[model samples]
Target: MNQFKNGDKAYVIYRNPHTQNVATIQEAIITESPENNEELSLFLMDTHYPLQDDYAIYTTYEEAVKMYNYYFEDNEQSEM
Candidate 1:
């Protein structure tokens, strides 16, 4: 499983590419299910925008990190 430390910045996918949205990693939690399997939920800073506020689910934390970096990092670099 991938681990994301608190305070890492992440981007949530937005419907419009022109209007980018990003969130800061506020918390990470691991919960045990009835099957004794572990699940993860990454809490983000509340975005005032309705569309951007929420937790995004991923099978693994690694996947979430990748998705977050892909959209956020690439865009930031290109802007520079």
Candidate 2:
């Protein structure tokens, strides 16, 4: 089942492996999947990301930030 509809606003936490920078929150738009009608995709950074478990999509910026802090910031602090 599709959790999002076309044109819906969404948020995602992006972490660049090449740069190894802190995770940043990015805003995206839910769009109809070009490959499948039953699924939805995220239009982010001029790219299409399929709405799958591989990418965690949030409904709000706060939610995305909270998850980012939990996974990234907290881990970094704990390592110190």
TM-score of each: 0.36, 0.83
Report the number of the highest-lDDT candidate: 2
Superposed by TM-score, candidate 2 places the C-alpha of residue 56 at a distance from the truth, in angstroms, of 1.6
What residue runs in model 1 are displaced by over 4 Å at the alpha carbon?
1-22, 25-55
Residue-wise C-alpha lDDT for candidate 2, range 1-80, written one tens digit per residue = 25678999999888886887656888999987788877788999998878887787898889998999889888989999
Clashing pairs in 2: none
TM-score attained by model 2: 0.83
Which ranges in model 2 have alpha carbons more than 4 Å from their true place?
Answer: none
Error of 2 at 74 (Å): 1.0
Model 1, range 1-80, lDDT digits (tens) per residue? Answer: 24433333434333344644645323333333333334333333432221122545344556767776876788889999
